[model samples]
Each structure stands twice: as structure tokens, then as C-alpha cells.
Target: EPQGKIDTGAEYEAPRNEIEQKLVQIWEDVLDIDNIGINDDFFSLGGDSIKSIQVISRAKAKGYYFEVKDIFNNSNIKALSKCIKKNALTISQDEVVGEVELTPIQKWFFERNFEEKQHWNQSVMLFSKDGFEKEAFEKAFEAIIIHHDALRMVYKNENGEIHQINRGTSEKLYDLNVYEGLSEKEITEKCDEIQGSINLEEGPLVKLSLFKTHKGDHLLIAIHHLVIDGVSWRILFEDLSKAYEMAKDGEDIILQDKTTSFKEWAVEQKKYADSYNMRKQLEYWSYIDKFDVRKLPKDKEVAVARIKDLRSVGFNLTKEETEKLLKHVNKAYNTEIEDVLLTALGLTISKWTGEKNILVNLESHGREEIVKNVDITRTIGWFTSQYPIVLSSSNEELGMMIKNTKDSLRRIPNKGIGYGIIKYLSKDKMEFKLKPEICFNYLGQF
Candidate 1:
């Protein structure tokens, strides 16, 4: 960890107050660690962006409210607790049900107009050794759909413009299927069928299939990409696990109070796009668009690369190496994991392609604090931002290259969120188009 941050295996101090004790408890639960100290660093304990949101959500459920940024600013329990306060704004308790505006990311998705858009989805297959009760699982899933309003979202093309609406609780939430004694190939085929079954125009964007086998049960969940993202999956998984346990135990399932709804966030994003601050970012984005970076030479070119054309090679680092990379190395450079990884990537590209100016399409989680008093830390929806960045790898020295790359990334305003705002939501029509061949997204440790 850092200079004075408490190590997980070392002696540590305890929480000093009730708030600190509560925060410690939440941290322990969310981080899946035992006896987390008041001064322990969250990231050091495998706490990431997703876990941070879980902490905030669970804390909110306990009537302690704070912004997501507060966690980053004050990572430890004692420090973070000092920043916590009673929620000032009156958050709506009623179910969020109405027409929802498309976020910049959603607008970007529609602009692509991809073929077979309905098949564009995110899915997960979870296994339970003990298996699940059908009725209990249904109840849990129903509660999840009702709690997370975005899962009920449906789209329609009206006058060539796509419109999104949040269906009421009375509507069907998900499609569920049960299978018994299915072979592996059969299970794979069933998953494929369900994956392709997601409908965007009609209702029911979420699908579930439970397979019963001699060993265990496999549950497959497929959700339309428009309604969910990486962060949303974490929230969904946690809620499903909790709600299922409660239902299995024959207890009333009561989930945490919803954070700012996705609908509210959509509206707030539109307003922020038109704000003076958003307009100020036009120059920065324009500069990025104008940056001249030659594309890397490819071994062979294809007219169009489909999913089948893609190939991936995986590698692993030793546990000791991973420890140094995640904890120790950052202390020397005063940087994050992304900075070091990008620095290495930029250097390698420069050496191989003889290109000092490297262009990259960067992706961020997009839950930035752009608008004041707007929080979507616990809200479930697709909130990913994609924008172009140019990394200057002119420096030959290792130290200089790392510093330069770190600076280049840090220079991005609001994690490059404004680029999408200006491109999709701004009134002024500017022809700002730049596409990089390579996209870099560092999804932190799961």
C-alpha cells in the first residue's frame, strides 16, 4: 500500500466512532474482507469502482449518504465517515416508471445502427451447487425487475427517431425457462437461443434460463446491452444473491432504497450537455480530433471483421508480480494501474511501429460527477463513454514515458465524458470525426 496505509495482514487500528464502525462493517461486507481497519486503503483491499458503489449503496440503505467521489477522496473508514452526512435532497421512494431519455452512450449506440441490434447483449452464466427453488427464484427476479426500473425499458422507432420508455411494474419483467437433464451441447444451444431472443422494441429485455443437472444447476442471464453495463451487472448480481437468499428463507425481500433513477440521470445529462462548462470542452475535443497519428501497419487486411474473425491470447502474471503491480509499483510513480499499463503499451507500440504519437479509443465507466447534486453511483443503466485520446510516446527514458503517459491521461477533462456530450447532445453541429484502430479499456479486477 501507500506510506502509512494499513496492510491487511498487519496490525491495525479499530474504528473510533459509530459512523466509523458502520463504515468498517460496510467495507468488510462489500470488500469480502474480515476486520478491516479504520486506516486501511480500500483499493489495497481489492475494493474497486464496483465495490465502491456497493459500499455507497449499502451505506445509503443504512441511512448514511455520501457521494462516490467522497470515497476516492477519503479512502479509509475514519476519513470517509467524516465526509458522510444525511442525504440533503429528497430522493423519490416511488417506483421509477415513465419515458426515459437516452444517455450519450445510448445515443452513440443508436448512431452505429449495427446489423442485428437485438443480439447486442451482455450475459452471464452462474452455477449453484445446491440449485435454486423455482418459485423463490421467480420472486427474487421479480423483485429485482421492479427495483431496477431500467430492466423494464423498451424502445420504439417513432418517425425514424428511437424512443425509450420505462414499462410499469405490472408488465412482464423477464423470460424464464427450466431445463432438466440437458447435455453440455444442449445447454450451449439453449444459451445461444436465449441470447438471440432479446427484443428491443417489444417488452422483456432480460432473459433467464435454469438448467438442472446431476451435479448442480446453471442459471443463464442475458440482458440487452442498451439497459445494462459492467457496473449494472455487479449491482444486479448482488441484489439477486441477497433477494434469492431472503426468498429461499421465506422472508420478505426488501432491497435498498433506489439511488437517483436512471430516468433522472438521462434528463440531467441532457441539461449538463447544454451547460457552459460542457461547451468549454469543445476546444479540447476538437484538438483531439485534429491530432495526426498514423495507423499501425497490419499483417493482413479484411474488408470487414466479424465476431468470428476475432482471436484472443491470454497470459498471467505471478502472484508476487501482481502484488507489486497492484500495490507497490504505484507508490514509486504516484500513478494508478491504468497509467503503468498504458505507458508500457505506448512504449511497445512506439518501438514496433516507429510511431511517437499513438492514438487510442479510450473507454471509461462514465459515472462522473459532471452535474452538481446528481448521483448515479447505485443506479443501474448503461453509462459507458468512448472517446479518442493521443498518447505522446516521444520520450525514450522509462521514467519520462510513464510520467508523460500519466499526464496525457490526466489531462482528459472529466475522463473524456465531454467528448460524447458535445458529439451527441450539443446543439451546434460540428463535424468532429476521429476513429482509432485500437480501443483500450482497463476493466479493473473483478
Candidate 2:
């Protein structure tokens, strides 16, 4: 074991081992940043707690299961690797439920009336043994298809009935290649070639492209986030890794997947009424929006829905300055950094709207929290939710106002209304129509 073990509970430090390099690669890929040190703390290095769940959840893909506490305990890459055991996640069976019908969320997507396309524009991550055995990788993939329902989903009809994601048998792998040292432009071309493999309206719901680099003793693997959501991806990684590990050992892989399929969930959700909570939310929203802002923000005025311009702005504070700011904020109010950010935006809206109390529709992801103990790593569906947050602010002390606004927002049910389904559900109903014209998203994944 690499001897740099610190109480991940105490100080931050780097892990010293070959394993850290893999951790660094995974973190860099997931965080989309580079130059991470072995001792660098994920959150301290700019990873939020929400993203932490995603990172640790995916530990399975790499042949390990990182308890949320593990990352915190081994805050640095070196420490994390010291604790990881080879064949840790090796299992005998798949780690997912039986393939079911389209989930309630998937059904909601088909009703959105968006242009239907056959190919699912999703990202995927695949891993194999360090030795780069092409023959074994092929066999592993074949086993995945045989054991799991790879291309099965359900869509909802106008009549509120559900149907399979596509009406056909899933296709088998016709080709597989793992390349390295390709230029960015070359990688783009490779992506185009991989896109040809997806059949959104037919066999497959998403595309999978593999890119591998021979790093002497190990391999660098990167997965995309298209066909599967964060949760499902982790399940896929863990199960896939276990499968490959078992194959290497000449043992039958065991999975901890779900007993029923996503399809089963969809067909069952319909027996429940969508009105209970959703309708109550609508009533609360309608009641709150009676008094509108002086003028809607510029974002809502456009007749067409285009992506809001995403401008990333960063700033730094000196150690002393940081301490002082945190102290003052803490003294004035009890809140977190997230609350502060929301408050500032709310106040900014107030400045523009002249409306002291403003409601902004915020988008949140709802990937987990379903089927407790069930591994949903590869089950992709529209797992996001939206909620109305009323930011009450004043001309003075905008920061304080923001902090308070967020505190109030923390109380609402968090299952955010992701656009994929929310858009379709409220398509024709004015009641389900959005309340606030202005919106904000702190997409942890993006």
C-alpha cells in the first residue's frame, strides 16, 4: 500500500502509486480539467458534492466500488488507489434489473412532439483488461448483449398508452476497435463513424464508441453520457468491469442488476395518477405567478427556444480575503455557497424586473432516488425535474437576499422536472405551462 494515508477526514494530501494515474485520468475526463495532483481533493479542486456522487458511483467501471466515504477518506488519488483491491467488484451475474418496458419518464419524451430521429445521440464508456485482449473484449460484449436487454425502451402515446422504445430485436456488434494517439480532428471523424452505429427509433437507443490509449502498463478509458444517465452509466461500468474481470479468471460473472426492466416501471407508473403532486405543483405555481415582474427578462422574450448563452466566469480570493468573506457571510446568515449563488442571480433579476419577489424556474437532475438498492447504472431515461423558486430580494444587501432565497428553495421536493418529460407533459396544457419566464440551471453533470 502507498504509505501516504491521511485521515481523509483531516488534511488533504496526494496518493503515491501507479493507481493514482488512472484516478487522475478518470477525474480529469469527468471534471474536464487537467493537472490534478494525487493529493488534490475533488471538491477543493472544484468538484461539487453532486458531482462527487457521480464520480464515486462510477468507481465500478474501473473494477472498484467507492463508497461515498472512500473518496472523502482518501481525498487524494494515491490514497484512493491504496485502498482499491483488484477484482473488488468481480460478480457472477449482471448488476441490473430485468429489461422492462419504457419507464414513465421515457414515455413522456415521445409525447414532446419533437422531431423523431432513429439514432440516440448518447455517450458511452467501455472498459477491458489492461492487457488489451481484443478477443476477450469481444466475448465480454457479446455476453453483455445476451444477458441484458441492450435496446429496449417504451414511449407513451397521445392516448396515454405506452409502447416499446422500438419494435425490433437489438443488433449485434459488427465491429470493435480501440485506437490511440489520434489528433482532435481525427477523433471527430471517428465519432462520425461511431454515430452510424446508433438506431434511436429502431434497434439501439444510443451509440457506443471506444477509444483506448496504450499507457505501457494500463489503459485509459473514456465513456460518453448520451444513451445512459449518470446513474445508469455507473451500473454499466461496474457490471461490465465485473464481467471482464470474471472472464479473465474463467469464472461466470454474476450481476446485482434489477429484477424487472425499465419497461415494467413505465407500465406500472400509469396506474398511479400524475395529478396528485404535479397538479398541486401547478396550483401553487399559478397562485404564485398572479403578480408578474415589471417586465420579463430578455431570456424569455425570444419566440424560439434556444440555448441560453453560457458564459463561464471565474474569480479567486486571497486566503485572508476568502476567510473574511466566508466569516462575514456566515455571521450574517447560515447558508451554503450554493445558496449564495442562487441569491445573487435572484437579486440580479430583481434589479432588472423591479419585482422584489421574483419566481425563477430552476432545472435539477433526478437520476437516483428510485428503486432503492437497485443498480440503475445503464438504464437511461429523462431523469431531470423543474421547480419554481421565488427569489425575494431588495436593492440593498443583494447577497443577503440571495442567501435567504436559496434557504427557502432548499425546502421543496427536489425531484426536478427535467425538460425531456416535463416539456411533453405540459405540451397542450396551459396549467402545466411554465410559471417563471426566467430560468436557471446548475447542471452538475454538464
Candidate 3:
């Protein structure tokens, strides 16, 4: 079998047909590229799941209805053009669906909202060498909020059930906090003071504060975790940088194409829950539920205190050792680093608790290949999929344990996304709750 060839510098022809021309334009707009060729591959040009959703959303706006699967299946502009279902439906580029159902992760957050609200916030502080362009940066920032619908969501409770409503744009701007001539301690205190003050119920989840100091400008952006995740931040930063540069140069604020709205995803998820594959996976989970696992040690059986004080502890191996474990050792055992890590965890926990079998909750990115043409590459929201996995440390040999862990994970249908689908969206309304005490997640690389 012959694999595809790589020719980065190869020249390609322009789009021929009218459909191809329009598709090329969409590709250029979504990928932030200029003059995209008809033959250019979508994935090769930085089209991810989120971006794929944007492409389809933009296409729908242009009266060319298509799904994410079409983009994946077609791959190129010419092929995608032929695949799109031409329609006369006209939807505004800025108009998004209102009153959407809460995603699984969002529901999880709401269930635990009795505790500290500020802990559910995701924030970053950026120190740019040169001062930011006041007008340009403001416009760029506004464009970002307008482009992503999730950034404009506010949660509301209807009949005791919480739902997210998409409110268009906000009049909020990046207010500058003057910390000039102030001591370092004062600046630190001011930042902390502002960080602790954010209303979760506010429509606009994203807020910015600029600190003008003697050295340089420090831009602090804080967004609620319900609207943005780790991957969403990367897309936001990239778009911000590009938008800022364009606006500074007196160019039009043209962001990449819009992805599928989060509201649409919620509707699709409901439909997918009733699917045959999802039903089959639910059966598998039911079968696995029969086995009982040991729980971790805790002070109180029925805890009454809210989890207020939380902290993170990080550990990293040497670069060489990390690479050897991730690449060489994984390849030799025909397994992944996650499997090895999980097996090691099982061994370590068994030693501590004296339990051969244990159940732990594993968090997945939740962007599985379920709906054929739906893409969420650029769609930002809490899309975490959490499921329970039973790990056994009964095996004495390390190799056998690793193999067992890998096999166990491989048995999960659609990366455990089906669990969330069935639990939240299924019409059966069966109460299936499996809460594992310990949670494990591996973020590959940021």
C-alpha cells in the first residue's frame, strides 16, 4: 500500500467552478489563509474538529448546507463543493440559537455549584513587550466574543432544570487598571482582588483587565470554565493575536469562519443517544457495572462541607525518560502512555489501599466521531466526558498489567462518550449513576 506524499512547496491550481470558488473562500476565511487552492486538504491546512464545525456553519450561512463528515470525507475544496447540499436558507452569520440544553460537563458543574463559584474560573495573564493598541485590541477582543457563541452564554434555571441561553454581544470592554508607580506587592494584590470578583450569572463569561505598569502592559483574561477549556484558550489566543495585528494595521477585522453552534451540538447529542450504537455501548457498560471495586479512604461517609480548598500538585519526568516511556516503551508493548500510567497507578494504589481492584473516573476530551458531519474543532464549551474505569492490580507482572489496562480501555465504545450521551440525553430516563472518588486525566501537551 502506498501512503500519501508530502510536498509542502508544490504549486497548485486555483478553483474552477463557482461552488469550488466559494468553498475556497470559506477555507481561506476559516483557516486564516490567503488564496486557498481547490486541491488543498482541509486537515493539512489546520482544519481541526472545532474549525470543521466553523466551516460547516459558514457554509450553511452561504446557502451551502453541509456536515462535518462531508468535510472529512471530501477533504478538499473541489470534492467538498460537490458534496454540499445546496439550499436557499438564509441565516445571519451572527445569529445563533437561543435557550440551549446544558452539556454533560455543564450539568456536572451546576450540580456542584453549591460550593465556591470562583474555583470554576479559567484565567491567564499575558505580558506583552509593547503596550496594546487601545482601539484595535478592543475591536479584536469584541470580534472574538462575537465569533464564539459559547462566550456569550448565560445559565438560567427553568422548572428546576438549568439551561444555557445565548445572549448576543456585550457592551463590556477591557478596562485598564493603572498600577503605575505602585509597588510589586500592590500590583500583585490588585490582580488577586480583581480575579476574585466575577459574577458567574453574567451573560458575557469572558472578562479582561489591563494593568499599565512602568515595565510593560500585562493583559489578564478570565473566563468561566463552563464556556472555555484548554483547547479553546489556544484558539482564542491565536485569533486574538491575528485580530490585533490586523486591526493595528488598519485592516478589516476578519476572523476565521464560524463553527457549528453549541446549541446545534446539544440537539445532535439528543438524537445520537437514541442511536443503535449508543444503545449497544450502554449494554456493555451495564455488563461491566456488575463488578464491585474498592473505594479510597475518606474522613466522612456523608460529607456536608463544600469543597472550598483545592490545590494542584504536578510532577514531570526527565525529557529522555518521558519520551522513552511515551514512544519506545509504548511501541514495544503495543500500548499507549495512558495505559502504562493507569497500570502503574493501579499498582501504586493497590499497594496503598491493599485492594486488588479499584474504580476511578477518567476524563476524556469528549470530541468523539459520533455524528457524521458534525465538527467541534473551533466550537468552545465544556465538552469533557467523564466515565468510570475498573482497574485490577491482581496481576503480579508489570507487562501483563499494562496489557490488561490497554485491553480494558480499548473495550470502551467511542472513548466513553456514549456514557454521557445515554446518561443525559436518553429518553429511557433510567437512573445510572456511577460516581468514582478518584479522577484521572492526562492532557498530552498544551
- State which candidate has the highest TM-score: 1
Off by over 4 Å in 1: 1-11, 44-47
Q: Rank the candidates by lDDT, best first.
A: 1, 3, 2
lDDT for every model? Answer: 0.84, 0.51, 0.72
Please give the TM-score that candidate 3 achieves against the real structure: 0.76
lDDT per residue (tens digit) for residues 1-446 in model 2: 23433122334334355567668777777666556667665654545545556665456566655554466567667667767755443223433333345433454454444442333345543344454565655556556544544334323243645445432334442245566777657766777667555444234343344555553212222222223454455455656677777777787766544333444434433332254545455554555446555447564454554334556678877967654443334334544445666777876777766778777777654543333234333343444455566777876665556556755765554344423233344433443443566677664444
Candidate 2 Cα misplacement greater than 4 A, ranges: 1-108, 115-120, 124-132, 140-151, 154-162, 166-183, 211-227, 248-250, 274-282, 288-338, 348-359, 367-380, 396-399, 414-430, 435-439, 443-446
**Residue 66: error of model 1 in Å?**
2.2
What's the number of clashes in each of the models? 0, 50, 13
Clash count, candidate 2: 50
Sequence-dependent TM-score of model 2: 0.58
Q: Against the true structure, what is each candidate's TM-score?
A: 0.93, 0.58, 0.76
Cα error, candidate 1, residue 136 (Å)? 0.5
For residues 197-241, write the lDDT of model 1, one tens digit per residue: 888889699999999999999999999989999888888888998
lDDT of 3 by residue, 263-344 (tens): 8788788888888888778778886677676568866576564445556677979977754564356545656567878998
